[model samples]
Target: MTVIIFTVSVLCLLPQEVLARWACVRACPPSCTCTQEKSCSVLCDRSGLAELPKEFPCEASAINLDKNRLKFLSERAFGTLPSLKSLSLDHNNISFITPGAFKGLSNLVELKMAHNEYISYLHTRTFTGVKKLVHLDLSDCNLFSIPDRIFIEQTALKELLCFQNNFRRIPGAIRGMENLTHIYLERNKIEAVAYNSLLGLGSLKYLNLQENRINVIHEQAFQDLTRLENLYLNDNLLSDLPKLAFKGLSRLKMLNLGGNQLTNLSKTWFSDQVELEVLYLDRNQLLYIEEGTFENLTSLITLHLNSNNLTTLPFPVFQPIYFLGRLYLFRNPWECDCSLEWLKEWMENYKLVRDIPCASPSSVAGLDLGEVVFAKVNGTCVDPADLNLTTASSEITSTTENRFKSLIFTLIHPEFGDQMGNGTESLRNGTLIESEDGQLSAGVTGQRAWPSESLFCFIVMWLSLGLIGQSDLFFSLYCT
Candidate 1:
């Protein structure tokens, strides 16, 4: 009877053990650890995972397989994880992805495939079943090119990061992504942007093309990108731009053109950009800008013109840009002189002006223009015409005063006055003490009628008026 009880107990314990092992296998994947609280979240990251587990929990919502040794993604790589919304395969050794690799992952929303150095190409149908994917990151993948229409089925994709690649030019078919709102393509090898290159990207708002070799941008390059707001083109090889290069970007707000080779800007370049707010032109070779080049950009809030070869800008160039809130003019070879008087006043009144330290005319070099007095910069010819008039009048007055003094000295001297031959004499008060016939010099043969008497009064009036400027003040004080 005891042996019979032991056998029955053993059978019960064996079934319980088997059931416990089955439960453990169902709850967690062999190659990954599932969170107990969520029941469907798995973390297979950095586990030396060479490939997707033979079976993943059907209810898993997130799978993080980043920093793994996965090399290839064959068809049905994840085996139809219907509930998976986010999958991270970043920092993996993924080299090839079969066309149907992501089949049946219709619920997947975000996928990260960055830092996969061996990935150079992608098949056109690689994302065939991942129609609901919203954000895709394929940056730093050593990609040289991609098949056209590779992203056509990703209708819901909003943000795409494919920077730090070797693409020689933007794939023309990328313009078909009408649902995309942001695209990052910086640190690439794109050399030029052809007209209508971004034709169908109507919903795009931000684009980054910085750190590229973009040397040319054809007119209407952004033809249909009407809704684009922020554009970055800094750190490129661009030296010039077509007049209508930004023709259709009416809603653009911020533009970065720093670290380029631009030498000049045209007046109509910004004609259609009515909503531009910030502009950067620093680190260029700009020597001049056409007058009224920024007239249409009246809404500009910030402008950077630093680190260039600009010596001066025309007075009217900034007339229409009256709403500027921030201005940067540092590191340019500014020729501080009378011509900069208006600029100095503008900068002082704007209050948000940055370093405008003079870079030329050694007298004011390294000095902040906003602090220098306008009168000193303009020198004596603040108003050229007025200065010339004042100088001419001064010379005439000096000559007349000298002539009057000589006449008065001759008449007042005892020796010269009586020896006037016809006799002409005057006292300190112009009383005319002697005449031609010894009667106070009325009118004589060789003398004068007291030199018209008015001459003495004129001299006396001038002296009393005290109109002698500094240059003649000393002479008048002692002579008079």
Candidate 2:
């Protein structure tokens, strides 16, 4: 009788809203705790809750029922909480959420139902009244299949995290969600990305498909994602790439393609990715790269090609990347031979934070390639022009003076004059080969031909120096 009188006295002393909140707290189930601070909250986590807590606070704005034994959420689980904004039911034994379970939480903005391994299926109308949801995390749920049009009503949803599931393909559940900007589908059993798989998600900018079994991707898989910026495709079974694999990603900035079985990089692999700044191709079996492969990546800043099987790179491979700020070429079996002279020069000239280490050539096996002494690189690779000059010099040394005069005559005038005439025809005809003006004419224009005078002077100079046996002097004076 005294307790009833004290309760009546406290109720009379409280304001109307406080009295109403007190009544709601009193109605809460004995096992759950209800708090009324700035916004009412219900905490029922790991409290052996077999079902949804009964008669939770009416003004509750958040409910946390994580790590519980709850099996299902029936209709009107939290009745008529118009201001409720967030709900988390993670790590529960829930296998199903009945339709209209969230019937009246109209302002719900975030829902976390992750780690519910038994929840392999979701009723289409389970999120019936959560129209304003913006973020949903359902990762690690072991979901094998999902129904279509499951998130069609969440027009404002921006992020959907569904990694570490059993999805064999990108779930068609988000087909009509145009506002979603991020989706995580890593650590799944996704084998391939079919054509138009992600059709309606135009606003999506960040996509993570790493750590999957994806070995193939259709050319038109990501055609509708015009605004996508960051894409992660690392740790997959992609042994080869299609020509137009990245055709539609013009504004892409970062791409991760590490840990694959790719044996080579073709010239046409990356398509329409002009704005790309960071590229990762580490941990591949790349043994060759076609010339001019990276010619179109003018805006690229950072490039990673570490942990490959490359023995040598072409001379012009990095010609197009003038603005490159960082480059990685470590862990390759670089053959430090004559062909690697260009690499030595590039290492000395191009500034890099990491030194390129050589893995071959016993002398420089463990040393940085920049420190190697390329003694045979200077003009050792003979030029064709030099070879022709050497052949001509050898012929001049073996020939007699008579042949030397005849050869000099042929150089001064077209049509070798005569094997025996020497300059006799030129002197008699006065050919007027304007030697001073560097011109050659056949008949005399006004004065005697200078070809005869020049030829006579060359013969005198050769005879004075006895150049018939000295091919080096002759080549230096004439071939030069």
Candidate 3:
């Protein structure tokens, strides 16, 4: 009795499984391949499908309709596919999508409609019911702007790709998506970054705005993106920036500002970026960089300042980045002088120093800065401190000579000679007197004045002999 019951159970379940498989194969659309390895999958890629086929297997969980000629997505196009979790409509001629086009795809998690160039506009209700969508690709679609509230139902979306489009600004439709983590909007026409443009997206991590026309960034434009880790603004037209333009992004790891028109940098620009690891300022028109510009980037590992108009950089500008591993400073007209002596010392502790050729000072021209510093360290390069002191001493000597010449002139002037009757008395009294010509006549005002004509003559003779002996020294110090 037990054997018969076991055999009967096997007989009952075996045909049902076979029938289900047969039904799935029978329900598949013509010219489409169907598979049931784990869940039903329909692949109609490159089949030249003009429209979505009506007969899809009931158990279909994924459908790929790529490389089709479908120009329109009508209402309820894929009707009541409750089990549909993935759909692809890429590389199609899809130009129009009616309201309620995706009404019944409640369980859909991924939808791809990329490479459809004719889809320049979308209705507000185009994505009505796919609330569980986590990824969507609408890139290269020539979309200028997305209708507001088009993504209102996509509360679970995490990644959005809308790159290579005609957007002049960041779309307002993705403002409040709290779950979105990645956004690719590179190669667009975005001109400026307004303050409220990315207001409510608190969870965004990776944002790509490269190859755009972004010239202006309003102060605190990225204030709401506290969790953003990577941001790409390379290949733009930015020449200047507000002081607080990059505020509130403390967790950013990578920032690309290469290929722009920036002429200088401010120290406060990266004040809040303590966690930044990589920075790209290459291929810009940068002429000056303020000290401590990268001071707050304590975690920075790589930096790019190559291909700019920089002549020299203060060594202190890079002293704060302790963990810097790679630095690109090539293609710049670097003026290697004694002022960059500290750079040679700093480069010794790091192993990845690129060649920095000198552009000025013919003695060091065409040589790497490190080699020049090595060759000139032994009394060849003048210490800047000593140079400053020598300059100060020369100024003092010049002033002293000018004052002595004025005193001699006062002694010989005819108008002063007429006043000489009391000049001797005035000199004895240490008082300064003015001549008829309003010239300051040296008198005894407790200040140094010629005590006697004989003393002045003796001093002049002594200076004449001393100058003759030191003529070579004077020429070497001043003429060169």
Candidate with the greatest TM-score versus the true structure: 3
Which regions in candidate 1 have their CA more than 4 angstroms from the true location?
Answer: 1-26, 36-39, 376-480
Clashing pairs in 3: 430-444, 430-445, 431-444
- Tens digits of per-residue lDDT, candidate 2, 1-480, equal 557445544554566678564654664556777777777777888898787754555556788889988888888766666757889999988887888888878899989999999888877887887899999998999689778867768889999999999999999888768999999999999999887679888898999999999999987677788888999999999998887788788888899999888999888766577888999999999999888788888889999898999888777876787458888888988776656676667667876635667777765778777776655325584322344466677665545444445446655655544332323432333232435575653333355444454555456546644555553455334422
* CA error at residue 194 for candidate 3, angstroms: 0.7
lDDT of 1 by residue, 129-216 (tens): 9999999999999899888788878888999999999999986657778888999999999999987568788999999999999999
Candidate 2's C-alpha lDDT?
Answer: 0.75
TM-score of 3: 0.75
The Cα error of candidate 3 at residue 188, in Å, is 0.9
Arranged by TM-score with the best first, the candidates are 3, 1, 2
Residue 171 of model 2: what lDDT?
A: 90
Q: Could you tell me the TM-score of candidate 2?
A: 0.71
Candidate 1 minimal-lDDT segment of 10 residues = 423-432
Native-structure RMSD, model 2: 15.8
- Considering every candidate listed, which one attains the maximal lDDT? 3
TM-score for all predictions? 0.73, 0.71, 0.75
